[model samples]
Target: MNVFVSLLRTGVPALGGWLVALAARHGLHIDGDAVAGVLTPTAVFLYYTVFRFAEEHVSPRFGWLLGYARPPEYKALPA
Candidate 1:
């Protein structure tokens, strides 16, 4: 379920953005309740449909080209 995990990791932020846009469209201020409302199944479907394609073409790089380093919190996780 790597794909599912990846979707969840990305979907949360996209859902937030969708809620923000919905609020802005109606000239309403965004808050936690607004965000929750916007993050319905429809919003998640739209975000997943768009971002899955984008993610497919992007490659990961670590410890090269970017002077990459793992965060200390990452090391502490049980593996």
Candidate 2:
């Protein structure tokens, strides 16, 4: 399950960025690498935005997409 979720989480956004580059190549005159360079960060931002929301407001299960099926380790500083 975690593997599937991880794959989807990675594959979808990457596919989206590639698709954008494809569309831009068809319509615009810009280079594909440049378009991907711009869209990659946008895709990542959007991915985090959506999944973070799902993880918080929707269900804890969504955390699987973000690789935190449970909370992280807690470390207290020395007194």
TM-score each candidate: 0.34, 0.56
Model 1, 20-75: lDDT tens digits are 45755466556756555655545655654544444444432321111222111222
Q: RMSD to native for every prediction?
A: 9.4, 5.4
Worst 10 residues of 2 by lDDT: 66-75
TM-score of model 1 (CA atoms): 0.34
lDDT by residue for model 2 (1-79), tens:
5456566666655665566556665776778678778876676667667876887898989767655563344457899
In order, the Cα lDDT scores of the candidates are: 0.47, 0.66
Pick by TM-score: which candidate is best? Answer: 2
Please give the distance, in angstroms, between residue 22's alpha carbon in candidate 1 and its true position after superposition.
4.0
For lDDT, the strongest prediction is: 2
Per-residue error (Å), model 2, residue 26: 7.8
